[model samples]
Target: MRSTMTNLWHPVIGIQISDLGEKRFMFKFFHRMGLERVIKGSPWTFNNHLLMLYLLNEGEDPLRVPLILVVFLVQIHGVPQGFFTEALAHQLGGFLETFFGV
Candidate 1:
């Protein structure tokens, strides 16, 4: 998992992944951009299963934090001309939950 993720992310500064047991892993990124990129690119999967992620605060326990929420990028096909707009994207995203971006 570590090797695959390291190769996938390819962080500039580097990253350290620690096994926290119970199928939990802590990812420490040396660069802020890397961290943001990872978080923004959410709903990651491993071994055909969903990989949950959360940003840990100082002194926060990885085992205690809730990993419930995840962002999804939904693809829509065959839109009518002039119907494809930011507002339409927001409406579509709202159907799922919150609309962060188009």
Candidate 2:
């Protein structure tokens, strides 16, 4: 049977799934597979609620968000490729280590 989901592609990366290091690609994949819309909000709100709380606590300027998040935005908007040549490395290392006994 043919796959119903649209294939996720990125210009520089070619096929996105081939670069699992790009977390943003996973979002696009989920979108094409119809899983993104099954939930309430789009990917931007995926972690906003929690991050908002962190921002409220830290009193950090929203303009000064950590680099990891900015990387995601940069990747999405196709900003200066010279700036962010790649996505941040695997963020779940410690979590996976803790949960899955890696």
Candidate 3:
């Protein structure tokens, strides 16, 4: 005895599941956290603070110039270790370098 069967099926509709990936999800998270504004404001504030310190220490505290510069550098370079990721920190540093010629 022998039995044979043949069947074929296909779905007429489809579904899509969004992955969103890491970067998009991070962007959405930052947007939700309201950190985008801080990210935008950070470099400006950092630079202005440095400029003020430079002006205040011009003659009286000339020795503090290097210290102030070092602090600025630490803040710029340490963004990753603080709150920002490596990529964001690098981008922020680049923006500051471009704007401040530092």
Once fitted onto the true fold, the runs of candidate 1 whose alpha carbons sit more than 4 angstroms away are 79-102
- Weakest 10 consecutive residues, lDDT, candidate 3? 1-10
Alpha-carbon TM-score of each model against the true structure? 0.73, 0.16, 0.23
Enumerate residue pairs that collide in model 3: none
Comparing 2 with 3 on lDDT, the higher-scoring candidate is 3
Query: What's the TM for model 3?
Result: 0.23
lDDT of 3 by residue, 3-89 (tens): 110011111232122233331111112132233332333333222342222222225534333432423444444333467777786
Error of 1 at 96 (Å): 6.2
At residue 98, give the lDDT of candidate 3: 93
* Tens-digit per-residue lDDT, 16-47, candidate 1: 99999989999999999998988777778888
Question: Deviation in angstroms for 69 in model 3?
Answer: 5.2
The RMSD (Cα, Å) of candidate 3 is 24.9
Instruction: Check candidate 2 and list the clashing pairs.
Output: none
**Winning model by lDDT:** 1
lDDT of each: 0.85, 0.31, 0.34
